[model samples]
Target: MTGSFAVTKHAEGAGVIRLAVRGEIDDEVSDALAGIVANAAAQPGVTALVIDLEKVRFLAAAGISALLEGRAATLQHGCSYQVVNARGVVHGVLATTGLLSLFQTTIRRTAAHR
Candidate 1:
């Protein structure tokens, strides 16, 4: 509701880590996001990292910074990274900042067709 945040890791493909982020991402969780992404990227057999923000309701500037930092870390580690499911305000912020290219952006579609 107010300031809740959570990150859950899910395995993807042969070497990928998908982090599903939920709740508001403000100053408090921004640092945590960076740390989590860095650690996950550094883990063995992790060649790709995905930050799914479909459930994220509110994303502040700090959160944007974290995503940028996380992308840098992934590139530094030679690991592919992408942030998906960014819609509404999150999409606007990322688009306005020209980060859509940095992190291959994609929306999470509901299960209806295909």
Candidate 2:
């Protein structure tokens, strides 16, 4: 693999838990991500979950499956789920897989200096 995946968790909003994922998400890393998603949903007051895939370099089939499972887990928990901040290759994978419309995604913007 050209890259490794790492996950970090943060409370981005009231009742929202954001799981920020970095690097490649192939077979080796997808399972771990599912666990994170499940844990986030089980947290008290977490009515919504967002998986930030902005930094993901590669997303394979396993990764996509994990995300789908995460969405299902959220629904089972009576919470809302979304995947945001995906760009380039990551975004393309989601689009081609027809998953882009399944979850809510927003482009993250950075400040520009003139």
- The local distance difference test score of each candidate is 0.87, 0.86
RMSD of 1: 2.4
In model 2, which regions exceed 4 Å deviation?
Answer: 1-3, 109-114
Worst 10 residues of 2 by lDDT: 105-114
- Each candidate structure's TM-score, on Cα atoms with residue i matched to residue i, is 0.90, 0.89
lDDT of 1 by residue, 1-111 (tens): 346799999886789889989998889889998999999998988999989988898889999999989999988898999998998888888899988887998985533
lDDT of 2: 0.86
**How many clashes in candidate 1?**
0
Mind giving the per-residue lDDT tens digits that candidate 2 earns over 10-105? 886789888889998888878889888998998999999989887898899999999998899889999999898888999999999888878977
The residue pairs that clash in candidate 1, if any, are none
Top-scoring candidate (lDDT): 1
Instruction: Give the TM-score (vs. native) of candidate 2.
Output: 0.89
Which residue pairs clash within candidate 2?
Answer: none
Residue 64 of model 1: what lDDT? 93
